[model samples]
Target chain A: MEDIWKGLMHAGALLFGGDPGVWEIIGLSLRVSGLAVVLATAVGVPLGYVLGSRKFRGRTFIQVIVNTGMGLPPVVAGLIVYMFLSRSGPIAAFATDVLNWWDPAAAPHDAPRLLFTVGAMLVAQVIISCPLVIGVTAAAVGSVPLEMRLQARSLGATSWHEALLTITEARRGVMAAIVAGFGGIISEVGAVMLVGGNIEHSTRVMTTAIVLETQKGNFDVALALGIILIGMAFVINNGLTALQQSGSRYER
Target chain B: MSADARAGKSEPIIVAENLTVRYRKRTVLDVERFELYEGETHAVLGPSGSGKSTLLRVLGLLEKPATGRIWIDGAQAGSADREARLMMAAVFQNPYLFKGTVAENVAYGLKLRGVSAREREDRVDAALARVGLEGTQRHSALQLSGGEAQRVALARALVLEPRILLLDEPLSYLDPLIKRKLVADFSEILTTSGVSAIYVTHDQDEAMVVADRVSIMHEGRFVRSGTVDDVMGLPTDPWVADFIGMETALDGEIVDTEEGIARIMVGGQIIYACSMFCPGQKVLVGIRPEDVMLFAAQSEVPVSSARNRLTMRVEAIEPRGALVRVALRRDGLRLASSISRASLRDLDLEPGDDVTVLFKATAVHVAAAQGVPSRL
Candidate 1:
């Protein structure tokens, strides 16, 4: 117990004051996650809007794909990326030769320390979470009444303007989707840990750091990051609830 | 605003020709043909879910018709999207208002038409005042009552001053007094402004009172379309006759019993209906409840211009506030008449008391509506 407390203090001091390398790792984590979320949103939000607003063949089938992706195991994505990006494998020439990437039958570690990079972890988080964003956004935008849509169009609004107005009207639902998507990536474990390689000052976000600390028997450090992760989740949920309530006035 | 224009009504400004619309292989609206003339309030009267709204939507260009054509303001609407959308403005049954101030709602159409902010605000204020809701610039649109919401919708459409005003049951959500005021406001606007309008409603009397031409739409087509008097007085179909309160049809031979009066005897009872049918010629008799007047025992009112007045025993009196329906029997034939509560109270009328029924000859119409023979 005393060792746990002592380890906690050391980790806290290292996080806040002592080493610039820890802050660098945190910065890398934010950069990678931010880049991934932005890319996914750019591709997914338009897809969701199209699915919700337009009608065509295979829509339900595509919706099924989105729903299935929402529960996709993160480790599976990490393994797939490991095989595809590893040295001596399908795209091996692009990776470092240090990776043992030739055989698909081997375990995930046979791929390489490409997993030790921040980009790999970003890919994993985006893969694990983008489906949730698309699904929630589709549901949100679909709730806009068809009457209002027709009314706006007849009043001379172009199609793009109609889409913009709908987004403004359904702000609460879209906000909730964003928060849910953020929570998904920020708290993800299997994909981040597997693809991130859990290096102390390289690929470790708060999620991966917690996993690594637990492995090293540093209960205090792991517990501290866990608390922070849960706190972030709490803030996001409350913020979304506030926004939804604020926008509920127009919902007839 | 010119009395000359109102009196000498001209041809229709807008015409919908063969406007058939299909939704997923089912015919939603099949108008075949209908037109709206200038300086006239043309009403599309139909029951609920009777394609009235679909026709409005197609006319307003909110939805494309599967097959049809619409010509507005003397321009063919087939090739022009921009001009067509600008030509007409519609107010839906449930007014579609934005989450904004009343002023913003009214200014939506003007803004779409490229009006500057200054001009938009001015026009919005003027439109609001015209709709009898002045100084409500900042009021939230959703906070408005049913009547106020409709006014805001009209204000939104009227701000642009489109050539055609299309309304889909605008007064459905309003109370009677509010509806009357809204109608009056519409009349004032129509009189003051030259904008033509197409109104859709279910109220028969309201259609008669407000519209210059009332078109009855049913079963994917309009069965009767003409002036209010023409449709009501000479209905083309038995369904229309039933729709317009034509209750009983009795067969009788017209007889010139008096100097300038004729009587109809139905089922051997002398139903002395006032008419100018040729003597000894058979004719059908039609009487609406409101046109028939009843009096008990002695009709103290001076007998003048009432060609048909007879003593009958009151079988029943059903009071419906402003009017009381008195059903009576005279010479073994049951006759029903409508009288005012004031008249009933003045006559001290009750059931089983003999009364004199008075009805004018010109007021009682003749028609070969249903299958009850052309000459009775």
Candidate 2:
């Protein structure tokens, strides 16, 4: 307990620019989460808008699938990605001759590949988090009033224009959905562990790093990382909620 | 008018042949034939639940008719979705302005049609000016009053430059003064622009004032349709007659019915009517309250020009704005007549004062309707 407290204090100090690696982890954590959230939002927002605005058979089934996927186990996603890239797996042969792109000095050794890299970790987290994005963004878009729809239609808006306006007007709500998704995936442990492999120098994301430290009985570092993760989750959730509430008021 | 319209110059701008709208298991509207001509105002007059709004929706293409064909400017509208969309625009009774500036709301339709930014701004400004909302372009739409919202709705529709404009009771909730002002402005502008309008309202007076042609709908069916004067002054249906402000509804047995003359007896006094009903048969007598004249110092009015002239005592004289509703009773027959306040004061009418009422036979109409209410 005492060591955990001391480590937390040290981590707090590290945040003030003492150790270079502490900054690196902070930067890497943000980069991974930021990239994952941006990609998810790019793909998810339009799809969610379509889901909310269009009418087609089996639409309810599609919504059900998205709602179910919002609660997907992140580790299960990590396992699936791992299988896709492992040596005995379908795409493993491509990575066997990885290009010596980053470091020519280690070119003779097993080459670094996108698999078990930060990119793969980010992809896994996005997979685990995008369904939540889809559900929330769809909800926000669906909440746009029928009066507006009629008004737009009466004004001669075609289907494509209507969709554009809905997305444009609902940009803030879509951002809120993305931020919530980030909160969801940043705290997720399973997929990051499976796909990133938690290598210390190359692929150690915050969640995987904390799990590795805890497993190795390094309680202080694990506790510090855990605190940081919780703090980020709290901030993202609260900020997203505030944004969504404001979005609703504007819509009304 | 376009090339198609000019080539078929004789065709009506709007024609709904045998239009019937049904929803789920209920038949909402069934109109046999309705036509709205170019550069004319046609009113669909009916009380609430009388399918006035449903007819407007069908005409505006907002609601599709279950069975009918709509022709606009000599074009088969059902076949041309784009043409139908561009040809007609509707202003709902409650003008639901979108959350935006007045200029933005007005410019929305032009923008959707890919009008240039500068042209859109100019047209929006011009449309606002036309609706008497000049210099209100930058005002917030939510801050507009009810009448102003209605004007905005009108501007929104007008800015589209549609050939046919549909309004669903567009001036329903306005004060009478505002209503009169809007009615005058709308008529004058529509006339100048040569824009045909299908205006719906429950107020028969509005219909009478504005409609070149009036259609009285009841239970989703048009009970009567004609020029406003034709429908109001010479109604073919008893309901239409009553609806057109013919307030005195009397039932009596015809006596001494013969060619060129008919006598009707009520409780005690014998009243003559100018109709073809044979003696000893009951007939419904309808006379406009305005058609009956009240007089003091009983004079023997002309005997049989209208057939039902009687001496009745003034029961009450209620002063209405610019008109007086005089209630009178003669030998158990009670009737109300709408007379000018000038005439009331000239006659010096008071309650319980004997007054002679001359009912011109030309002003009295007799008809037979099954289950006609005795009190109507």
Candidate 3:
């Protein structure tokens, strides 16, 4: 109990006292998770809308795959991204060839070296969060009755316009999907720890730093990092909740 | 010329031929030919699943028929013709309003069309006022009652100022009191706007009250289409007669005819009908419940001349609003008579009472035999 109180005090001071190291870790965490969620939203939302609105053969099969992917283990995702970006992997060779043309001096000469890097962590986080976005967003779009779409079309909306109207009507659920994706990746430790390699000043994030600090018996710093991570999640989710609630005031 | 005269000079708003719609292997709508003229309210009336709604959808361009050609305002309308579809608006049975304020919901179609904000607001306000919802612009659509929600839906569509409006059982979801009120309001709106409309419903009363022309649909095809009185008063088929709630339909053979009065033999009883039919022709006889009068069997037969008067045993009596529906049977021939409750009480009629059923010969409508079997 005493240790927890002392840890809380230290966590508050770290947050308010302009601690450069703590801020850097927090910034890296936000950047990786933020980029991952943005990319995931860009890819997943449209895929989800198509999956939810259209009727085609193999749709159920694809839905089953997505539903399964929603619950995919983070460590397994990390393992897949790690293997794909490794020296002998197909993607690594393609990426190496592409990077070589862009910046030959900066490119690795011996092998693809994406492993244990911020980009690798980002890839893993995207993989971990994208399915969640797709699954939730699909549900959100599906929950909007088909009659609404028909009404819009009857009112002179093109198919694209109808899709926009449906998305606007389902804004609350879509916002929730983005928030869930962000939360999923930010709180995730396994994938980022495995792929990021937890390098200080380069790939270290709050979650990974907490793990490192706790292992090193630096309980106060570890607890502070935990507190900061929770605070960050609460702040983000609070804003999203406010948005969602405001949208629901007129919902039937 | 007045606007109504100008509208009359314009081409018909809609024309459909060989329109056939099928679901799976079952045909749902198979109208050979249909037309909607400018500034007219045409009703397609039928029971549930009689394909009235399917026909409405096809006409509204919301559903593509299996095979058909539709011309809207003299232009061929393919399934994907946005301009053709934009010329019409539809309100379904349920008031499916998008989540928004009433003003926003009503302005949605205008916004989609890129109408200026000032014009959209003006149109929205006018539409709301037309529907008698003048002050409900800023109200949340979700907070509306059933009737109010439906009115907002109407405002939404009316704001578009479409050339034609399609209504599918629009009042069927409302409470009776609300439906009554809306019926009057909607009738006034339709008349004042003079927008061509296709109103589809199963309620005959609604059809009669709201439509200048009524089409009776049965089994995926129109059985009768004409002015309301022509279709209701002179149904061409027994099924339509029965559907329009004629109380008695009897299978009979024409025994004799003179001067357009045919005496028919029904259940060993001779009945006169004021219709021309060849002797020995098989026919179905129909009489409306309101056309049948009842009197105490012991009382002197009415002084006025009624061609058909027969003693009947009352089988059942049911109270219906201000009237009592008395079901009568005689030698397996059954008839229903709707008489005022005061007369019912004056006669002291009850189930199993002997009563006299009187109807004029002209009240009996006769249809040929082949199409009459389906009604039975």
* TM-score of every candidate relative to the true structure: 0.78, 0.71, 0.85
Listed per prediction, chain B TM-scores read 0.76, 0.73, 0.77
Model 2 lDDT per residue over B1-376, tens place: 3323432454478988888888777888999898887777788988788888888777766666889988778777762265576777778777877656889889878887889999999999899999999999988787888889889988998999988888788898888899999988877877788778898998877786677778889889998876665456555565765555554356667777666467776656676656676666766555567888766765555545555657788777777668888877876676678899778778887898888788776676565433643212
In the range A28-141, model 1's lDDT, one tens digit per residue, is 656776677776777667777777777799999989999988877777877887666555556544443333355434424333445457777877777766887788778888
Model 3 misplaced regions, further than 4 Å? A96-112, B1-12, B17-33, B217-226, B234-242, B247-286, B300-324, B327-335, B340-354, B358-376
Error of 1 at A113 (Å): 10
lDDT of each: 0.73, 0.75, 0.87
Q: What TM-score does structure 1 among the candidates reach? A: 0.78
Model 3 has a DockQ score of: 0.69
Which of the two, 1 or 2, has more lDDT?
2
lDDT tens digits by residue: candidate 3, A1-252: 988998999998998998999999999999999999999999999988888888889999999999888899999999998888888898878877787888888766556688889999999999988889998889999999987887888888888998898888888888988998898899999988888899999999988999999999988999999998888888999999998888778866
User: Candidate 2, which segments miss by more than 4 Å at Cα?
Assistant: A1-12, A18-43, A54-56, A70-130, A167-176, A194-197, A201-203, A213-252, B1-10, B49-54, B173-181, B232-376
In angstroms, give how far residue B45 of model 3 lies from its true place.
Answer: 2.8
